[model samples]
Target: MKICLVGSSGGHLTHLHLLEPFWGNKERFWVTFDKEDAKNILANERKYNCYFPTNRNVKNLIKNTYLAFKILKSEKPDIIISSGAAVAVPFFFVGKLLKIKTVYIEVFDRIDKPTLTGKLVYAVTDLFIVQWEEMRKVYPKAINLGGIF
Candidate 1:
């Protein structure tokens, strides 16, 4: 299956990277920031850099939404996955409209509340995964998969 792994830089990127076991053998690409960590981690992988400072940033959000349309239309990935900090919102929404499956793994640290990205994409996510059991209360449909860390 072709997978589009989308996330913000740093922790969110690390969270998705830890799932290499599942995506390693698949045809996959990434959508993330063009920061040092992302550049280093995905040096040899296919990656598309997205707009940043996405939290409460309307301009970046609009820019990313366009980027999402462009990338999703071209890549045509079968699935879109992320452990996010806002950047995944546009991708998930676009992917849903394009009939692509989406999986959002909530960050491992948030136990009591849902992250803004998680809450925004939950409705469109095909499979919502939570690292902590308590997060299930915040996201009733989330599947408790323990932790990816």
Candidate 2:
């Protein structure tokens, strides 16, 4: 099945990469920022660069939303998975509208509290995965698969 892996740069992307064993062999591409770490790690992989100002930037959010629609239409991924930091929001929203299955993995660092993106995507995601057991309290329905790393 074709999969679209979406996440921001830095730790979020790092956490997603930890699942390479599971998704590496699948027909997949990535949606992430064009940063040094992302560039180096995804050097040989297919990817779509997402916009910046991820937090509260309405302008980039709008741009990313448009980008999401285009990507989803062309890629038509069977599933969309993300370890997020805002950049994954548009993709997940658009993917949901397109009836694409979505999986959101909570960031590995947040154990006690929930991340904003996690909260926002929780309702829409088909599966919400948390890396820490304590996080289960925050995301009651979340499946605690432990740390991806």
Question: What lDDT tens digits, residue by residue, belong to model 1 across residues 1-149?
Answer: 99999999999999899999999999999999999999999999999999988999999999999999999999899999999978899999999999999999998889989888888999999999998899989999989999777
**Per-model TM against the reference:** 0.98, 0.97
- Segments of candidate 2 deviating more than 4 angstroms: none
Tens digit per residue, CA lDDT, model 2, 1-149: 99999999899889889898989889999999999999999999999999996998999999999999999999999999998989889999999999999999998889979999999999999999998999999999999998777
Predicted structure 1, TM vs. truth:
0.98
- For every candidate, C-alpha RMSD to the true structure in Å: 0.7, 0.8
